[model samples]
Target: MKLTLDFYTRPQCNLCDEAYHLLQLFQDDWGFELSVRDISTNDTWTEEYGLRIPVLKYKDLLIDEGQFDLDIIRKRLHDLSSEN
Candidate 1:
């Protein structure tokens, strides 16, 4: 089985950029599919996320928000993948 994640972000956000980079860095190791969405592109997303950019989601599960450690995300992804 393969794990997939939704990475919610917006333009000109440094944190979002960092999160994207971190995900890309671990893509091979974690072997997961990533779908990046810019909240600013949609009205619903803009209202829903607002200032809470860079939210990571695995299906209905919330993985993390705001600033997070790369290792922490990796561990969480590992755990989630293991359950599959």
Candidate 2:
């Protein structure tokens, strides 16, 4: 089973960049699909998530946002994988 991740982000955000990099590292380890969504490109996204950039979603469920923890993410990976 392949896990898909939604990463919400926007331009000129260092935290967004960091989250992207962290997700890349996680993808390498867990082999998941990552989709990046730039809030700046959409009005709805920009309005709702403007201040909450770098949010991560897994199957419509929010997993985390900003300052991701390797240990917590690793645990989430383990938990999600076992569901399959």
**Winning model by lDDT:** 1
lDDT of 1 at 55: 92
Candidate 2 per-residue lDDT over residues 4-76, each given as its tens digit: 8888899899998987887787686786788899998999988977887788888777778877777777777
Clash count list over all predictions: 0, 0
- Tens-place lDDT per residue, model 1, 5-83, is 9999999999999889978888887888899988988999899876888899898887888996777788889889788
TM-score of each: 0.88, 0.86
lDDT of 2: 0.82
Give the whole-model CA lDDT for all candidates, comma-separated. 0.86, 0.82
